[model samples]
Target: MTGRENRRGRSRCREPQQSNHDVCVVPEEVSAHEGKPLYVLVALWCLKRGGWVNRGQIADAFGISERSATFQLTYLSRKKEQICCELRKVKRAGVPVESYEVRVTEVSPEAGVRKVSEKQREAVKTIQRGRVGNADGDVRELTRNIWNSLQRGRKA
Candidate 1:
């Protein structure tokens, strides 16, 4: 029997070879963020791939809707300086699409950290200051307060 064949005479399926670039090194901070884990992960994925990642690719990789992926990409593009990525809008097969290219393979300690404005900080404080009582009414009031605070912040 040939070395390539197993005892049953069927050829073994070989695993696809991977280059050094296929190895993705995720930083602690990327996964540490309570929020925006998908955004950070998509950035790292783009960096590891070293190419333009479209919304469909992001959606496939993260198991999210294409719109959600686009939103994350848009957010990253807006914060390109903080995230170290580049965004390009191009037409694929005559359909306009957005793609992201990560500028760095390695993430810095401060990467992806957004600077909170004082107004946003005050809003957070106001939400946190609400008392959490055992009563259902108290919980509803707290929820309403948080929702109102968010709406006010959005309007400002």
Candidate 2:
């Protein structure tokens, strides 16, 4: 066995892992950029993980400062319906850590976002069928009614 392997246990995987996930490594091409390119990498990571991905993992994978990682993550987190970024309390190695997750899609309804109910779904279907050159309802009133129907539920 190598001296380093002897010093550290062989079972210790060098790859960063959280829960059951192996963190994705940033591509060498990706590591070379500072702005939008890094943003793409962050987005890809979020999409791949399909849940919350942490900053330390991104930093280590890309050999970047956690600050840079945070900047990139925060940038992508702003695009609604595309990416959602939020701070969450998480336990890492049994210690609580403030973590961020960039969700590519909304798994849960966020604040200021509404969920559609049976009524809204029915309204939407009616709207779709009526939209084929038969839109007789006042646009403003129809919009308000649809909006109200969507916001009246807890995503059942």
Candidate 3:
């Protein structure tokens, strides 16, 4: 079987030919964050495809649910300044689909600095202040305190 054909002999989704210029440069902030790696993968996939990609296409390519694909696309849309893409609502075959136009050729490290709100900053500060030590007892205490605060409807 050829690379274009699956085991069942069905042709795979046509991806654009990759050239040297077709590169997805992930920024340090994206690489360092948890759960963002999937975002990076989706970005890279869209970049290589070089056109409007629908949620179903993303889901099939990544082996994820359509809802999860939508979430990834939505998150990427919010990072448009860093990823150099835009989200569009378009109809394909009379079905409305959420699509992303991947126009990113390269990304600089400086573009990855996400704007954090004052509330987010304060939350980070609170977590940092709560970290007394790396010992097992300290870690357990911190977790318990966070759980308790969450149960009490307070910010952890």
Candidate 4:
């Protein structure tokens, strides 16, 4: 298949390298499609939310169906070469469904091109879960300490 067709069908691309100044200069081969700018923008939007986003969200925002939203997300996550994002089913209310997140490793090559990775995909999920859990744990501990202090004051 042609390169663009290959990307559309969800193929991988070469990993990009960081420049001396630490900016990522993604090679041109990353995103093969010319119409992926909107996809990348939406992906970034989802990533910034730092949580699960369903197909419905994309459809409502972009005026498309769940399937088309999925297709676009899949194409960007799987097919586009340079940008790396993660999509997985996180259990919510006992239903298995798709949600997405991304790590901003670089500026997109263009508005119509997005580059992402399979390796970092798993990392994205783990990192987000870990961050949230850690924050929750901290809050719980702080609350317990405060309660303990209040009890001591009452005794005094």
Candidate 5:
């Protein structure tokens, strides 16, 4: 047996685990000048994670401060032309402030235009076709009669 192998009972191939060392190091923060588009993209990324993605995860992923994340999210909320996203503050122990969780809702790419789904269109058509009737017919007839009487009175 070699002198080194004899001296130590265990093999030297085994080494202590270095779990504390990060496999990848992310930067500290994102540049501030890029504006709100960055926030929208970040929000989308968070939502794509398949569940309620909180603000801290967003901040960590983007290498930004929580305050920056909040500001970006708030800006995203105000942009009428952008995708609709929801943010709710979550309260938990050891967190300095209530962190936000982002949920994406379906919205039209072009804002301020009527964008109704097929189901909604069918519902409207059904209503117009009298599948749904006004329970108070007397009230409706009275309003029509009042308009006719006014037209007659105007002629008289």
Candidate 6:
């Protein structure tokens, strides 16, 4: 099946990565689809809030159906280990069915992406905005440089 068709029916993504104010850039071979950008944005928004976000909230925010929201959230939960997020069902008074919530976890170290502090996040954004290197350069080196600088500051 073609990539678009595959994505319209699929409910998962490759090793998911999250950044600020930009689209995800997974390898094309394992890429999920164009909608991944939405998912990443929503997930990051939820992360910044420092609280669980429900399916209804995500649906309303993205203007998608609850089912579709669930799919997007499920895709993220599937990569929870990589993304440091988890899904939980919360009970509401007088509601027969429980709704889902996404919560960021503290286990980001073992995950694919390291836990980024607010200061570090801002620093990375500043460095990225001032970037002058090859656009296609590996971001790992950039992350490493930032990390080294942060470590040195801590040591001094």
Best candidate according to lDDT = 6
Task: Report lDDT per candidate.
Answer: 0.57, 0.54, 0.58, 0.51, 0.54, 0.60
Write down the TM-score of every candidate: 0.45, 0.38, 0.44, 0.38, 0.40, 0.43
lDDT of 4 at 91: 54
Q: Kindly give the stretch of ten consecutive residues in candidate 5 with the minimal lDDT sum.
A: 24-33
Task: RMSD for all candidates, in order, please.
Answer: 15.7, 19.0, 13.6, 18.6, 22.6, 17.7
- Model 1 segments more than 4 A misplaced: 1-36, 94-106, 112-156
lDDT score for candidate 6 against the true structure: 0.60
lDDT of 4 by residue, 1-156 (tens): 122323334432222232321111112333334234445655655655556666676665544566667676675566445555655654557667535533334335554433578877877876643243445677978987999999999999
Whole-structure CA lDDT of model 2: 0.54
How many clashes show up per model? 0, 0, 0, 9, 0, 0
Best by TM-score: 1
lDDT score, candidate 2, position 19? 52
Model 1 C-alpha lDDT per residue in residues 62-141, reported as the tens digit of each score? 54667777787886676555577666656558657544433434434566567899999999877744556556887788
Q: If both were scored by TM-score, which would come out higher, candidate 1 or candidate 3?
A: 1
Model 2 Cα lDDT, one tens digit per residue, 61-103: 5556788788867766665564455545565586666567555
Model 3 lDDT tens row, 35-150: 33456657766777777787877777654677777787886777756677766666558657435433435443435356799999999877756556667987788899998988
For model 6 the TM-score comes to: 0.43
lDDT of 5 by residue, 17-132 (tens): 35442221122232221222355445455445656766667666654666667676776677656667776788889868666676766333443335699999898877655435
